[model samples]
Target chain A: MSRLSIRSFSSSPIASKVGYSTVQPVHHLIPIKKQTLGKRFPELNIPKDDIRSPQYKPKDVYQDRVNEYYQNVLKSDLLLHYYEHDSEAVTGNKARSWGEFSPYAVYRRDRKPKGLSRATRDIKPVTPRNIPELTGISINLYNKAALEESWINISARLQLAQITNVKPKVVYNKSNVLPWKVRQGKECGCKVELEGRDMTRFLSTLVELVLPRIRTFKGIKDSSGDKSGNITFGLSPEEIKFFPEIENFQELFPNLFGFHLTFKTNAGTDERARTLLTSLGLPFYKEVKNVQ
Target chain B: MWKSGLRKYSAAASSTASAGNSTSISSTLLLTRNPVITADVSKFEAQYYKYQNELWKRLMWTFPSWFYYRKGTISEQAFRELNPGPVFNNPNIEFPRGRPVVVHQRDRRFKQELKLPKTYKEVSQEKKEGGETAAEEEGAKEDNLSRQIVPNSRITKADESKDLASLERQLSRTLYLIIQENSKWTLPTFKEEQVAQGDDTKDSSVTPLHTLAEQGLYKIGGNSINYFNVSNTPCHVHKSESTREYFIKSHILSGRFVPQSESIKFLWLTKEELGEYLEKDYYKEIEHLLSDI
Candidate 1:
């Protein structure tokens, strides 16, 4: 193992602004000359730039690396599809076409040349402007009445970033809750809304690896879905540990907290949303019957 | 620094007190916050039923069929000329106003294809150079040949005496195609699979039932085919022919069966249906192993 770098703590004595004395226990009472501790141990001296310069933090560095990975590796034909009209966003659209996995399902709709005497203004089967599909995933981390430590919020943000493979934004309280000691604009937790390929990939991992490994999980409850079709589920701290990314590196996260995961589907009804989720291999359980 | 230590101790005590107070407060706060977790059940019921009622109303609205119109009408004449009521144009025959069907349509205009993840074979081939050296080429060829246990040429020779030996052993595990000949249902009869004498039989280590099952006997055009065995193992093997012929029971996991030959008119019937439809002699012969027909 490498020896501890003295430069890291060379300036610590100066920071204390007080010297320890064995001969004179009451050094504060006795007059003494200021000591240059660095002169005695030159190896302990760190460069001025190293001590005072503002540098990118470890989380920032990791976030940059993740962004690079998302751009170079994850953003490909297997994930993102580029439109022909918007070429710059697409970047040579023909090169990275969806190929066999194109989302648009086409059908030949033969319409007789329409005129003033057309039977109906609308086309057959009603060609939709957009298809019903998974739009995004919203993950909310709720920290109950704990807003004092910025480090906890930062760690939670980093944890979410690590799990989602995307940077998370810290959420602040919109209104003050006097009893809970929550003040308006105080950072409480973090959230991440993933869309496009990232959304699908995160969902796939949750369905295939994460949920199956969780012992206490009994599938998404039937009553969990909102009236508008979005389904929400809660994971306990123990269940969060089952995520393969976190499970493999337990030491990195000392206090892993759970979050509420919401799947935002374009399917208008709960039944269609359930069907879509089922197709993605997420099992749904029937509501438990209540005793009379 | 000595004075700061005393200050830090006091700060820590205050922080712990606050933490304890917050925890207790939040617990009580949760009772009021319960509304945030639970959803409105009656609202969901209203929304779900509203969608269902709309779907039911849509289902009642039928498409205007050209056949229902008068023969002299323009719609009927156009329908006859165009013939646009789900022929080869719409092979799936999905109802126009029904549930949305998702299809994967390949865009031929896209010429530049992105690289897919390489397989082990491809990685090895790249390491050896693009020419595909003799050893690797032979290995690939062997793999391809092995995957096809029964060659197309041997499909006709499936009923030979040499092949029948293994079929009789695995009779309870194979699926036999029952055909309707002159309105009388009976199991499909196989002819001999032709092979040249001393024709590389050394390479083939497959049983007759596996070989027969893989063949395109009841051909499914273009669609991929797969087979899986039924799990109801019979106590006794059923054989109709005195020559000791036997067949295994299996199901088509995927693919639709279209007849390769005009003479092959088949139906997938249950054991009881087969018992009712087939001749008494045929049904009686296979009665013991008719749990899954």
Candidate 2:
């Protein structure tokens, strides 16, 4: 290997000055092609000048952005069309996201529970037959808290993505607290989105299988506030698949899947958020009962 | 019709080819510079239909459709194109009217700035004089033939299959059609690659990581699996497919996974009740099924 130069992140690290406080402008992503990709993937034979060029023109970036937005929105809708019948996110048959995966499900790690307890589960994780996850591992989510008792669920929803062999998406909705308005500014809205295709092969085993085992649990109330209950979340595109309800969707619809975790809160304050989640019979974190 | 990015990408590509000492393929077939003006759906659908139909006929009749049988791969591709995502286009999406503001962060791209790394595949003066001995050429004639596996990395169910001919041919045809419709066509260019003889790659055969890196299959995530060696056995952070690969490789490199004994194997759960199942070395013997349908 004398001729080949190898660099390791552990040894020589190029630290990112940007913190993960808010979203980072994806600035520019140079596809870090595999070394042999020189021999293997001729498709990436992008012109050096193009790649080496400082940055795309503003108009070019703008055009690309417009195309990407429409596609992302439609893609999310098509994926989440199934939740329409069950969720209240639809208006005149339209779906949306508020902040769906974070509060009760994610920080709590209850998206995919590893074990099944007759005493604890209402909808035990089935054989994972219909909705094949990319991860070979599957968790049974029959209750709202299958994996652990902690709140502020920030688990890798992808842990179960690879096991079931379905396309995986990393969901990051913070909470599922619903809002006061029916169509507009509802903080309780839950969100959904598609993560990525690159993680298909080398996806982490925990993400592909184990973590979901920790997250699976029960869901929201059947009659907390809805005539035909629906919630919204302000979700980015990556967090949609973590929701268990996507599979029940059969047909393709627009804006169906992209959303975030928002929940219907009877109380706007932290204590009220707990009381609200409690009333819904859904799980919620106790420490940050003050967080919206 | 459908403008092509191939040439535009190629023209910009040519500038980088100057970085190395190799015969330039930029002057080859990739010679169109037409900006892929994504037109209104009408023209897009027209050209897309033609390309899709032609591609469908060629691929379906001659090639295996099993990999892309989602109803004429080109058609699906066209459909997606005619309907590209909005996030790529919508710069202000984060600021939807009356919405909470989320911050945008930037990651310092891995700034290795490749401190003048030496080339692995250096051409011998004699080889260069012998002049471009067609790279195992004629191999392309077997249009239906799958790309030969390089045999460098271990093959698994998840890893991609190597089908060079199919990829080149498909790309070429699509590119050609794109060029025919575009007013400008420029071939894509890239920095000349560094290739070294096997002689240069042998200094560190003692370690599996070193060996794989020499093979060039080693990357940020490449690992050796089911091979016997020392460099192959480093513990990974997680146990997914990628992790298992590293684990297996590290073990093999360390002589833990014996190729002769069939000691290590991957199990696809035949059932979803794995949550209840006890952990056993079923790494080789268990088959799990999807817990949900």
The residue ranges of model 2 lying beyond 4 angstroms of the native Cα positions read A1-155, A158-292, B1-293
Estimate, for each residue in B83-149, the C-alpha lDDT of model 1 and write its tens digit: 3322223447674655332111111111112233465556656757876676865677686853323
Relative to the unseen true structure, what is the Cα RMSD of model 2? 31.8
lDDT of 2 by residue, B165-229 (tens): 12122210111111111233211112223334332234332233224322322221124423222
Model 1 chain A weakest 10-residue run by lDDT: A20-29
Those runs of model 1 whose alpha carbons end farther than 4 Å from true positions after fitting are: A1-130, B1-293
A1-292 per-residue lDDT for model 2 (tens digits): 3411221212111232211112112222344435555756554555533533222212111123223322422222222211111222112212223347556544442332324221121221112121112211122211122123212111222222222223233222243433511222212221122222222221233233322443433333332322212232232223434433333222221122232233332221233233323422334332323576
Residue A254 lDDT in model 2?
A: 18
- DockQ, every prediction: 0.01, 0.01
